[model samples]
Target chain A: MKSLARRLVLAVPLLWLLAFFVAPFAIVLKLSLSRAAMARPPYEPVFNLSDGFWGLVESARQFTFDSYSLLLSDWLYLDVYVSSLRIAGLATLIALLIGYPLALAMSRAPAHWRPILIVLAIAPFWTSFLVRVYAWIVILKDEGLLNHALLGMGLIAEPLRIFATEGAVLIGLVYAYLPFTVLPIFNALDKQDSALVEAAMDLGATKTSAFWSVTFPLSLPGLYAGALLMFIPAMGEFVIPDLLGGSNDLMIGRLLWAEFFSNRDWPMASAAAIVLLGLLLAPLLLFERAQSREADT
Target chain B: MPRIGASGFAALLLGFAFLYAPIGLLAIYSFNASKLVTVWGGFSTKWYWALLDNRLLLESLWVSLRVAFASASIATVLGSLAALVLARHGRFRGRTLFGAMIYAPLVMPEIVLGIALLLLFVALGLERGLLSIIIAHATLGMCFVAVLVHVRVKMLDRSLEDAAHDLGAGPFTVFFTITLPLIAPALLAGFLLAFTISLDDFVLASFLSGPGSTTLPMRVYAQVRLGVTPEVNAVSTLLLAFVGLVLLTGAAIAQRMRAV
Candidate 1:
């Protein structure tokens, strides 16, 4: 009875994941190989099983790589992919630059206040994400508070055009994902023993050298984790770019939305999504491998 | 730890300012009497009153709350079960695949997950509505719950469960009377985390929701795209307060659990 109960417990979640998680990817893959049409459902069904088992085999022959081919042939899709990577990459780098120091400071804070500092860092994340992005629109608009402050300080004679630009999108990305970047790095930094750094300093290493040699290397795992956390979502970000970015800043997320909704090309959109998944797979696998390694140790 | 250098202190100050300034500005402006978001007029509570009368916005908020509550509850159950299998049922078959399947949603792009699930629903002839949104939210949220519960499960002392088993208590009885109680805090944390994720979700809800079933984020997105208004600031401030309350309660519970 106990063994049966154990098997039942295992079976339920396994089946749930298989049906909900794994099967959907199969649908996406199948859809990517089908052709887009103007009819309902938009894409040609992959198989018609009603004609019997032989008919299923015959229907399989109808599958086409036309969507994939179109994606390959069009420089527009390729450019969107590249630009999305560039924007997300730049945002991740900037986040790392900003977040690393803040996390280091938090780690170096008085021990009694560490939890409060951590909570303060994470407080902003609890609010609605859309509201957070909307807050950016309020701050970056031409007649926005930023320009008002700059003008009042005589930093600029006129309001600078900061909104509806790639820079604004980058700012939004960094702001949205900053907590994600900081927490992991902070976790990594917090776990490191102070004794190691003190020992290095005792060996005649300066503070800066000690940090570089001892503290920084130990925090690499956190850095890597934070980078992946920020980079992955930043790549396929829809809301930030959609609201803050101008028409000129065409990331893959926007491109996919346009293809699926505007152009009504489900196959093309599925293909694009597949490619986006492919682009993200390497870093994701690396992260998973690192996590499993951590588990093993 | 070494004393933080001046530069480190400056960085923390600047970093925190960057994080909180926008949110602070939104909250402050929600009470603005003026129409424009930038031109801060004297304080007024009129937008809050206006929000009470906005039927569409109210309905969407209702939808969001219902979805969050339902999905979070369901995700907690399924996720805790999965975490239990992963933690206690050692070296199960297809364990690696199980781990990957559970964790994939955590890192998967929302757009990809949104579209993939949408496609799956359409293929299955399911109507897009609250039901679809709930299912999608549950699938996404369960992964988060799993991660949280899995960590807590790993940290649990095995001796108590072993002793219960040695006393001839059945596995089911041991799980119910001992294991469940010990992990209740994790279960609560997981539920709240999942609830927050579901409440804050926009992309998946937008993709899966039908014409009449817009969520709070989708409504806020539409309004914000049209133009910024103090009304949005009002709604956002209220949402912020709600989420802040939930998070504070979760933290307090966690702290008390630790104290015990």
Candidate 2:
């Protein structure tokens, strides 16, 4: 009876993930290789076991790399891929620059204040992500509050065109991902023994130099983890770019959305998704390694 | 342990200011009487009233709430089981694979998952609608719930359970009487997190939801894409306020659990 209960517990989530999560990837790969059909479901070689072995063979023969080749040969796809990497990279860097300091502050905060700071850091994250991004539209528009404040303060003569630009998307990306970047770094920094920094300082190193030599090196794992957390999602971020980006600022996510929804090309969209997943695997692996390293320490 | 100097403190203040500024402005503007969302004509509650009268928005809001409640419940059950497997049933076969499955969705791109699941639904000949959205959300949200609940489960005292077993209590009885109550806060946190994920989702739900099955975020996204309006601001403010209240309750629960 105990073994039955245990097996039931194990099998439920495992089988569900296999069916809902893992099987979908297999279906996506199959669809990516199949032909785009002008039908209700919009893909060809919809395989079934009713026709038996010959049907399987026939459907298997229809699989091709045409979509992938199109991705390679088309400059539009190439541009979108490059643009996505660039934007995500920039956003990650910006987030790191901003998040590192905030994390440092939180980590050094008094013990009673630490949890409050942590919660505050996580507050914006818990709010509606779409709402947060839309908040940017309210701030970055021509007559938006940001321009109003800047112009009133004599920072600019006229409103700067930030909305619907790559800049706007970058802001949205960094804002959305700031919590992911902050918490890991805070965990790393907070876990560091203060005695080590004191030891470095006592050994004739100045505060800044001691920080550079000892503290920064100890926090490398968290830095990598935080960067990956921000970069990976930002790479395939659909809503931010779709809402904030202008006509020419097409990212891979937006391109995939356009292809699938507007063009109704399922094969091409799946191929894009597959490639996007491929691009993320290395960073994802690095993130896992960083997390494990943090755990070990 | 005063690591931050005066300048560092100032920078920290600026950092938080940067974080909260947009949200602050958004909330303040939600009450703007102007149809032009940016212009501050005066303070009023008309937009809130306007939100009530917007039938499409109201329908989507209802859909979002229903989806959030159902998916969060399912995710909590599935996720609590997965968490048990991870935290309690150690050294099992294929444990690494199980852990990987739980962790992968936390980092995987929504678009990738969105398209993959859409294709899965299409292949399975399932109609895309409320049910599909719930399934997709539960799948995604369970990963988060598992992660959250796993942390609490790991931190749980095993001695109580062992003592219960020694006293002739079965696994089921110990779980219901002791384990469930002990980790109740984390379970609630996981549910709330899943609920928030389901409520806030746009991309995944957009892909799964069929015609006339628009979620609140989807409806808001469609409108916000056209331009910023006071109505979106009003709705967003309400969402922010609601989530804030939920988060505060979660925090209070955590604090109370810790105190005990």
Candidate 3:
């Protein structure tokens, strides 16, 4: 009975994930190898269980690499992939720069104030993400507040064309992801022994040198965690780019969206998704390792 | 703790300003009388009033709310169970795989999950609608719930549970009597987090929602795509307010529980 209860406990959530999470990936992989068709589901090689075992074998034989080959051959796909990487990379770096200082300050805050500071740091994240991104639209437009402020200050003669540009997308990505980076970094920095920094300073290292040699090095784990958190999702970010980016320079996320929704090409979208997942595998693995290490320590 | 230097303090202020300015601007502008989002007009509640009468927006909001509540409830249950598996069930078979599956969704791109689930539904001949969306969201949210609840579970005093068992309490009885109340705050936090995630989601809803199932985010995205409008601003402001209230309450509860 005890063994049965243990099995029951594990089986419930595990079965749910297997059915909903893992099974979907298997379906996507199979779909990516199938052809696009004008059917209700819009993909070929559909296995009809009613047709029995022979039909299943026949359908399996119909799988093709056409979708993947198309993706590889097209310069559009290649360009979007590269640009997505570049944009996600640049955004992660920018977020790190902005997040690091804030996290450091937050960690250095009075003990009584740390919880409030932490809440403040993460408060924006709990708000509607779309609303926050939409806020940028109102600010970055030609007749927007940002231009108005700049124009009022005589900073620029004309309204800067920031909206629907790569710059705007970068801003949105960094803004949306900043909290993710900050929390991990703050946790890392806050948990470290302050005595080490004091020891470095007592040994005659200047504050800046001591920070670089001791504090920063100690925060590497957090840095990696934060970067992975930011980079992985930013790479596949659709809403930010679709809303803020130019029509011509599509990210892979936007491209995949168009493939599935606008073009109704399930196979193509699945192929793009497969590639995107492949790209994220290394970082995801690193994150898992980092998480387990953190758990251990 | 070390003192935050002047420059670090300045950076903190600026960073927060950057983080908050957009949403703050949206809330402030929601009352702008003029349709032009940037232009300052006399303050009015016209947009808020307009939101009340807009049937499409109202319908979507209802759909979103129902979806959020249902999915969050389901996620909370499954996720709590998963948390127990991770924190209480020591070194179960396939534990590494279980851990990976739970964490993967947290970091995986939304678009990937959206499309993957969409395809799965299509393959299984399931209609895309509220039911589909709830399942997709629950799948996504359960991981977050598990992660959140796992923290509280790890911090639990095992001796209390052992004592309950020693005094002739069954596993279920001990779980219900001792463990459930102890982890209630984290469970509440997880539920709220899941609900917020479902409410704020667009990508999954976009792919999974069929006719008459448009979510508020989907509606807002469609509008925002066209251009900015005061009505969208009004809806966004309301959402921001609702989410902020929920989170602040959650934070307060968490803090209170920690103090105990």
lDDT of candidate 2 over A83-144, digit per residue (tens) = 99999999999999999988888887778888888878888888889899999999998888
Q: Summing lDDT over every window of 10 consecutive residues in candidate 2 chain A, give the lowest-scoring window.
A: A288-297
**Model number with the top lDDT:** 3
Candidate 2, chain A: TM-score against the reference: 0.97
Candidate 2 is graded, for docking, as medium
- Regions more than 4 Å wrong, model 3: B251-260
Which pairs, if any, clash in model 1?
A: none
**The candidate that achieves the highest DockQ relative to the unseen native structure:** 3
Top candidate by TM-score: 2
**Model 2: pairs clashing at backbone N, Cα or C within 3 Å:** none
* lDDT of the structure predicted as candidate 3: 0.92
Each model's interface RMSD (Å)?
1.3, 1.3, 1.4
Question: What's the ranking of the predictions by DockQ, best on top?
Answer: 3, 2, 1
Residue A243 in candidate 2, Cα distance off native in Å: 0.9
Model 1: residues with Cα > 4 Å off, grouped in runs: B254-260
Individual DockQ of the candidates?
0.75, 0.77, 0.79
lDDT of 3 by residue, B1-260 (tens): 44877987898789889988788888999999988888888899999998888999999999999999999999999999999899988886789899889988988889999988988888888889999999999998899999999999999999999999999999889989999989999999999999999999999999999998999999999999989889889999999999989988887997887687
